[model samples]
Target: MNVAASGTALKRLRRSARLIVLAPGPRVLMFRYDIPGRDPFWVTAGGECEPGESFEQAARRELFEETGITAEPGEQIARTTPEFVTPEGEPVRADERYFIVRVDSPDIDTSRQTDLEQAWMNEHRWFALDELDDWHEALYPETLRSLIEEHTA
Candidate 1:
């Protein structure tokens, strides 16, 4: 394990593939993560890539695993630059790539979520593009509105 300057044990670098799922209303689906000791935040469907899995493969798998929806992950859209710690308390430098996926229905099934996901992800909501600005909870990537506008336009 690598040690950071702050004496924190750094886990291996991880590659994450995220999906921005959009429905007929042009709304985006977000999961509310209520991790311990942290305020709730909403994020897209995604997770770390399994061994030897490509970003696209991981995106597809995560989409199914998290939402129970099987759809092809569309084009790459955005990426996050910061190194963040996972909810499991592991410090990781994650190469997070975002993709777009358009679906006909906004319904989601969380029955396939892993134990860790079920524990922390307590709620989910589909937000209209215009409502995101007024949303009280934090949304990851900070640039979500612009990213959606760019893609929709």
Candidate 2:
């Protein structure tokens, strides 16, 4: 086992950003990896804080690039981090901050997906808030889960 990384402190650069969608309704933008031999698992939309851009700007940029959806919601934002492992076995981490942006139109302009093997998500649907619990429990970070729970409660 690698012993040094365990004792090595993760000099966390707390990124102040946002997770775009929280509550369910019209359309919650999520992504799934189009692996060669497995079903897809949808995920929330978010990105890291840009050089000097605010979380909102990054969210909008990411949403458009990812789902081709342009959302302009009017709600307060939250910050947190979620854990993930890369397909290559390396660990991936992101300090995410999110806000609820109620979309203006129903038809999102998607097409930015470019990965030949990891692109082409089969489905995109708007689900109820209750539907989020399972995935959130499994995928979302503690801070994100707690924030969602408090809001739902």
Candidate 3:
């Protein structure tokens, strides 16, 4: 590992803001990414927080950037600290926070997705909260079900 000019190692922590967008049918927005020869996984809409941006600001920006949907950020429902390696093979510890937003429509536009996001985005769908259990245990937050129930109930 190389040290920085200040004699500090490079930071590996990434702060992200995500949203759980709910629609009129009480369904939540989710997206699936599948690669050939690998299991499919789902994720909510959001991305890394930009410099000089607050978590809420990042959530709003990413919600639009990733899904072309816009809504007011509600309660912060969950937070997690997880470490993983990026596609570029660099280790990253993610400080991810999730917020809830209810919307009237589910329409999405893909024109805004960054090249990196477009690479992994396969399809998007709206899922009924009751059916979330059938998706198994592969959701990004893993604790999503409980988080939803906590805030909505």
Candidate 4:
């Protein structure tokens, strides 16, 4: 879990996939971090909002932790609620906010977390946003599929 502001009350937050690296192959690159104590097995790169900070700031921090890339937040994309099952077979919902940001960095540094190790996963398994098998399963709204589809296409 990455901190939003590097302070106390670094509380747990609902998650969203802050998408960067929108490329030409109808592809949207996402960095998925592995957070312990969860089912569906992974969490996207995002965190709780910071005090007096925009959502963009928290997005950037999460991006840095998961991928080591820094980006300026761009247009708001989608809202989704990713569904997951707890280890004990209970259902939980996480509200997710999706956004577009162009990242520029030598490498994505996964150095921000001491608690969880970051891992990269493909957003769409069969193809870029095509196969429904490997879904992002957002915690917010579900418009990102279309937003990213339009952005890439």
Highest lDDT, which number? 1
Model 4 TM: 0.54
Candidate lDDT values, in order: 0.89, 0.54, 0.81, 0.50
lDDT of 2 by residue, 1-153 (tens): 233555853433435445446333433445555455544455565545668887667777767665676666345456555555433444545576667655555554457744542354544555455565665323333344455556545
- Model 1, 46: alpha-carbon shift in Å? 0.6
lDDT of 3 by residue, 1-153 (tens): 767899977648889998988887678888786645556788888878999898999998998888777777876778999886554456787999999988877788878988867777778888887778877736777777778888887
- The C-alpha stretches of model 2 lying farther than 4 A from their native spots are 1-18, 22-27, 35-40, 50-52, 72-76, 87-89, 116-122, 134-153
Clashing pairs in 3: none
Q: How many residue pairs clash in each candidate?
A: 0, 7, 0, 17
Candidate that beats the other on TM-score, 1 or 4, i.e. the better one: 1
lDDT of 3 at 20: 89
Best by TM-score: 1
- lDDT by residue (tens digit), candidate 4, 53-130: 566676777666656666666766666665655333445465566677653333445566534342323221212556
Question: What is the Å distance of residue 122 in model 3 from its true position?
Answer: 1.2
**TM-score per candidate, chains pooled:** 0.91, 0.61, 0.84, 0.54
CA lDDT of 145 in candidate 3? Answer: 74
By descending TM-score, how would the candidates be arranged? 1, 3, 2, 4
lDDT comparison, 2 vs 3, better candidate: 3
